[model samples]
Target: MWVLVFFDLPTETAKERKIYALFRKNILKDGFNMFQFSIYMRHCASRENAEVHIKRVKKILPEKGHVGIMCITDKQFGMMEIFHGHKTVSANAPIQQLEMF
Candidate 1:
């Protein structure tokens, strides 16, 4: 399974330090990796293993901070794609309205 984790923190001098400490401890013990700052992507052999890892991380996160996690299997991860579609409608209104007869 593959997992994506996001973390939001409060504004403080030691916020990053605290978050990193917890992350390092959990990752090292559970075999996770740092894909990005405040974001982590991981793979596990079984669903039980994945759940255990997430549970441990959740326990260490600061109560004041926000944490979001998204998990998918390896097969599903490969089939997922992000689409960026152009807007067909404009935000601003038409400048002229009375010229046509």
Candidate 2:
């Protein structure tokens, strides 16, 4: 599964910009990669694992602006079609994690 985070935070004032930067830093520290300017994503082993990351993101949400979290299966994610202008581009392969028992 993939955990995707979308956010649009206020950046009008210096304080608001600081908050936005911190929010982005926090999610990156949580293992999310920048899928786009305001979109971040992380690959998870399972729904439970995705939920844990989602909770962590929730805890650090800024007081202002909007944030959204979504989960998609590997199959669903793979079906996504990406393009760079007129050319089609392949999506980045998911990172493999070793599960220690």
Candidate 3:
């Protein structure tokens, strides 16, 4: 499973920018990688794990701005097509997750 976070936060003021920075930092600390500006994604070992990260993101949501959270199966994520300008590009390989039972 994958947990994808999409956000659009206000940054017109210094304080707003700080909030934006903190939000980004928090998500990064939670293992999300930069997919694009305002978009972060993390691969989870299972749906339950993805829910945990989703909850964390919800807990730290900014008081002002739009945020979206999505969960996609590995197969669905693999179907994504990425391109740069006129050329096609491959999506980044999902990070290998180690599970200990």
Per-model lDDT: 0.67, 0.95, 0.94
Quick one: ranking by lDDT, best first? 2, 3, 1
Model 3 spans with C-alpha error above 4 angstroms = none
- Residues 11-70 of candidate 3 have per-residue lDDT tens digits of 999999999999999999999999999999999999898989999999999999999999
Q: Return the top candidate by lDDT.
A: 2
Which residue pairs clash within candidate 3?
none
The TM-scores, one per candidate, come to 0.62, 0.96, 0.94
State the displacement of the C-alpha of residue 13, model 2, in Å, after optimal TM-score superposition.
Answer: 0.3
Give the range of the ten consecutive residues with the poorest summed lDDT in model 1. 89-98
Per residue, candidate 1 scores C-alpha lDDT tens digits across 1-101 of 77677877665768766766766667656755665577666776678867887887777767676889888877676665534376343222112324456
Per-residue error for 16 in candidate 2, Å, reads 0.2
**Candidates 1 and 2: which is better by TM-score?**
2
Report how far residue 58 has shifted in candidate 3, in Å. Answer: 0.8
Residue 51 of model 2 has an lDDT of 93
Each model's Cα RMSD: 17.5, 0.8, 1.1
Highest-scoring model, TM-score = 2
